[model samples]
Target: MEGFLEGIWHPLIDNEKCTNCGFCYNYCPKGVFEKNNQNIIVKNPADCVDGCHGCEWKCPGNAISFPKPITKEYVIKVIRWSKAKGRNVSKDFIKYALKNQIIQQDEVSKEMRD
Candidate 1:
């Protein structure tokens, strides 16, 4: 699942609300945010952790936001597609999705069967 979900989920910064604070840049462990001269920008959005919202939570101006919430249907679609493409879905990703309630336990098998 290394590059499977890349560029799918990422943060969007509201420039009006952003104060050019570097908190998000420093807080993001994935280097998703970077300081560009006077402003902080989303440099490598693909590197953002799927369920992690540390940058959004740490933003002092509340400028960060995701495009949409992850849904169970979406996860199932991804799983099915991955299987069709002969990609090995990561067990850790499945566990994380299950633990986070992004996909229900029973629904995984049901979706996979399709």
Candidate 2:
């Protein structure tokens, strides 16, 4: 997938709790997790998209923990990445994020300029 967040955010698997059922391996759309021999491991954490938690809930053993904080920088990064890919999501959403104080205005300005 394009613009996958990779290192910015990735799932943390608990080895002690993991049942090795491969749920994350099967469910990850971007191939973030892979089946290694009889076990499963995250092969490309950076390939995981921002704010995506599909693997967290899919793990029956509850071994996944993605503790990525969604800061203003992350918001801006996603916006810029999407725009660079020609996905014109509504500007109103950006305005709303600013008006609601979801992101700092300076951060948005810098992102737009970039």
TM match of model 2 to true structure: 0.55
Question: Residue 68 in model 1: shift from native, Å?
Answer: 1.6
- The regions of model 2 sitting more than 4 angstroms off are 1-6, 69-114
lDDT of each: 0.79, 0.75
Q: Runs in model 1 with CA error above 4 Å?
A: 1-6, 70-114
RMSD after Cα superposition, model 1: 5.6
Error of 1 at 52 (Å): 0.8
For 11-98, candidate 2 gives per-residue lDDT tens digits of 9999999999888898888998888899898888777876566787668998998767555766776777777887764476576567
- Ten residues in a row with the worst lDDT in model 2? 1-10
Per residue, candidate 1 scores C-alpha lDDT tens digits across 18-114 of 9996899888889988899999999998888764556776789989988866678667867887788787666766776798889888898886777
